[model samples]
Target: MSGRVSHTVDMSVKLGELTLRTPVLTASGTFASGREFADFIDLERLGAVVTKGVSLEPWEGSPSPRIAETPSGMLNSIGLQNPGVEAFCEDDLAWLSSVDVPVIVNVSGHTVLEYVSVIERLEVEPRVDAYEINISCPNVDSGGMAFGTACTPAEEVTRACRAATSRPLIVKLSPNVTDIAEIARAVVASGADGVSLINTLLGMAIDIRTFRPKLARIVGGLSGPAIKPVALRMVWQVAGAVDVPVIGMGGITDTEDAVEFMLAGATAISVGTANFVDPTTVMRVTDGLAEFCRTRSIARVSNLTGAMRT
Candidate 1:
């Protein structure tokens, strides 16, 4: 009975050489591993699970008031706060391995060496199927601006990490740049297997009563529906610039947003802030995508990638 329903539309997508049975994946940091959403969603239903940013050493994250709610979105300076790669390999990876899904580790660092160190360690881990190089974390070593804003450093980091791991490398891009397409091409040239775009635009909030910044860091990554338009534009531009697979993310909350991204040239999509509002958002988007295709008489969801004429 279920086989007949699934055959109606092909939801599979390929990120570089890695194929995913579905096009929807969880945005790193937003979904955690599977512990938080495990009760709300079936891990096996997702195309892949992108774990939070893991570094060479444990990070305490930022100070108090790291999160601040905004209009239609939120700002977070939680930093790359993680239990380090070694600890993650022992704890998180164990929980992830038990689930029937591919794991894409989101790697972060203070320098190219830091990124390489984590990648080198995970290279031997059988549970790691792919890597999502988080060059977009805002509360990190250089406030996330040092590495992701320019083409040179982005390429340098991508090149170093590419050489350190055999697994697929997906460079997550920051929108806090002049030309995102330029950065996209730079990373792909440096050997990025794929690219994830529009990772939280740098933003800030002010408290009227205190006459001070809402967040302690003053500036943080902004994500939610508010950035969807910006994210879509960037995805479209980057998708046209790079030949490698482009994974789109930024304000994806519903199937409509996911479909829009695919039409903009996203080979795959990731659900982020929306997860906090609805734990089962990913599952809803997945099922919604299938129903959309069936109603439109579309045969495969992959066909939606870059389907826009202009």
Candidate 2:
């Protein structure tokens, strides 16, 4: 009886040799901590579910005031908070694999060796279907050596990890750079199968009343609708520059925005900060795409990728 009303669109999308059900995916950090979201959102319906970045060691995250709301977005210095790789393998992966979705595990490290160490461990595990290397973490030890923003460091780490891991590598880029296209091309040259764009723009918000920074970290990465225009523009620019697949994300709060990215040449779209406001956002976005196709008599969502023009 319910099947009559249920309309499932062909959400299949391919990343290199990998295929996804829906082009709509969840971003790394914006994900809910538990597996309970499956019932409400239908994880299987998503193109992919990217877990929060996992590190070689457990992270307590930045001190209090880790997040703040900006004019159109929010700033976060949550500091890549995640259980260590070993802990994730035991506590998270078992349940993550239990889900019907394809899980792309985001791996983070401070140095080339750190990146290699993490992926080497993951290579043996079946829990993660792919890897997204996060090279943008603001460094405290090196006085802030952001890997993705710097072309040299970005290429080095990307090459190191790409060589270490067997899974499809998606190099997540930093929007803090002066030239996003340059870095995107660098990663692809270093052997990345694909690239994920515009990882949080670095920003700060001041508290007028308190006469201090809005967040405890003093600064944070901005996400949400505020960065939508910039993200879309960068996605389009980077898409033109790089030959590999581009996973477009940022300020994607709805399906229309996802379509905008697809037209802009994004092979797939990801939902970031929206998850905090709506836990069922993934399903809503995927369902919205399906409806968009049905109304237009479109047969598959794949045809929508890169359908945009200048």
The superposed Cα distance between candidate 1 and the true structure at residue 296, in angstroms, equals 1.0
Worst 10 residues of 2 by lDDT: 1-10
Model 2 pairs in collision: 11-21
Which lDDT tens digits does candidate 1 get at residues 1-310?
1332467798888887788989999999998897888988788979999998899999899886999999999999999889999999999998887888999999988888989999999988999999998888877656255788888899899999989887899999999888999999999999999999879988999999999999998989999999999999999999999899999999999999999999999999999999999999998899888888888999999999999985
Per-residue C-alpha lDDT of model 2 across residues 182-214, encoded as one tens digit per residue? 999988999999999778888888999989998
lDDT of 1 at 14: 87
lDDT of model number 2: 0.82
TM-score of 2: 0.94
Native-to-model Cα distance after best TM-score fit, residue 253 in candidate 2, in Å: 0.7
* Root-mean-square deviation (CA) per prediction: 1.5, 2.1
